[model samples]
Target: MDEFLEKVFEAAFKRESEQDENIVRSLPFFVAALGLVLAIFSQVVVRMPPVGTIASAFLYVLFGSATAIFSNILWCLFQLVRARDFKLPPNEERLLEWADSLQKFHKTGKRTRKAAEELAIVDVRRRLVEAYAEAAVDNRKSNRHKFKYRAQGFMGLVLLMVLASASVGVIFFDKTWRISHGQGATAEAAFPPPHREKRIDRTVRDGEAQASGAGSAD
Candidate 1:
């Protein structure tokens, strides 16, 4: 019975330790998601011009939504990584208490020393079991909280990516609409092409002047 109890506490401790390591390993993925959010915001939102027809107006709405989603994602990732009450190994105070109990058991009279040693051992085991149980419960709670935030952040990242793609499509659609409607002609009209007639006249005048100057030299 005692051996089984020990195994249970040991398993709980090991499981929580593994969970803590996993949370650390998963942090890089959260950071990568953050970078993706920034990349999409800059490429699809910040650089896009404000001038457009209906598509541009729709894109503006998407940009606003994306911005808000990314902000929330940032908050979620921050919560996931932020420091919290993670129960570590048994502290010095507990270890010293165990040692003091053992010393008292040894100092007892020789007749009771053997029994005292057994009781001390059981006491130490009980303390260890309590520590493991407490740490496991608290650490599991912390892990659950972190995982929840991470899940939220990951979903937000997926949504932002979709919005970015949609925004790109909207931009392309607006450009196509402008071209089909000849809305881009205004810029061409504003900067009219140079006169070919004026160029030809200048060329002729230069040729005549060059011929006259060469003839005089001859």
Candidate 2:
């Protein structure tokens, strides 16, 4: 039972060596930074939002973060998959082996550093250099567009916002023109107030003359 428990603990909360932990943490961070920039460039911002602005803003942040994290994950996965296709570089492996050899030489003080140097390690590095002479094809940068995996939804939303902005501009223009025309109509209507006053004055004078003539006849 104790052995089983120990195995379970190892599976659940296994501790990574310090070097491995550093590499794991740093690699994710470095890879994520790339996606962060890509996501930022890909995102669109909205301004002068309507009544539901706060709610919409919150939704935007939520979706945006999810997209950025997903993108980061995708980027990390891509790198891992690509690296898997290529066997561990001989140079990298040899470099590690050479360090181990140096440590062993130091521990066994009887052995000279020259005797500790492995010819196979030198040959490994040499083979790596000769095999890829002047041709270092970094697949990530070279086949960047090969994935054909785009955030279509994100781009669609960006274009939709642009169209919406143009639509709003058109609406505002129409309303402004309508208000100006309405004001002109009001001014025109007001211009004939003097004519109305003249008609009213003539009516009053005619009535007065009729009343005076009627009194004289009586």
Candidate 3:
């Protein structure tokens, strides 16, 4: 019975370790996703039309808003990858001490060989159960936190992708507007064109008047 219980405890501990390893393995994939999104976002921004009109202004604000949201999501992913404390097996030295104590107790004529063996198994089993319980509880909590963060990161990435696609659409629309308008739209286009004074040639007018006067005198 003790041996069977020990096996069960060992299995539980193995499961917790595997869970931790799985989370660690998933980190690289998340990082790669973030990098990909960042690259695409850069392209979108670089190709965005200049921000002089109402549409371009709205696009700038949308990009800024998307960036802020994405940053929060990135922080969540960072938290998921950050180091956390995990419980390990009972110390070997401590287990050895318990075994030695059991031997000493047996040598004092307090127990027969069979009884000593049974007691040793019972003591070891008790220690294993305690360690397994503590580790299982602590690891479960850690795993829950990791799972929560992982879910948040995943959802955040999805939202970011949607926003990025929308931004691309807006950029395309802006480009189309610029193309159809001859690319000469200015911020001041909202106002009328500037007025200029029409200049007159006073010297030419004065020479014409003098020639007419001399012809009349002749």
TM-score per model over all chains = 0.74, 0.26, 0.76
**Per-residue lDDT for 42-153 in model 2, tens only?**
4423222232434345545544665565565566445433432321234667677766765575547666666555543454445445333322233232233323323332
The TM-score-based order of candidates, best leading, equals: 3, 1, 2
Clashing pairs in 2: none
Better of 1 and 2 by TM-score: 1
Candidate 3 runs further than 4 Å off? 181-218
C-alpha positional error of residue 3 in candidate 3 after TM-score superposition, expressed in Å: 3.5
Local distance difference test values of all predictions, in order? 0.76, 0.46, 0.76
Candidate 1 accuracy as TM-score: 0.74
Better of 2 and 3 by lDDT: 3
Q: Candidate 1: worst 10 consecutive residues by lDDT?
A: 187-196
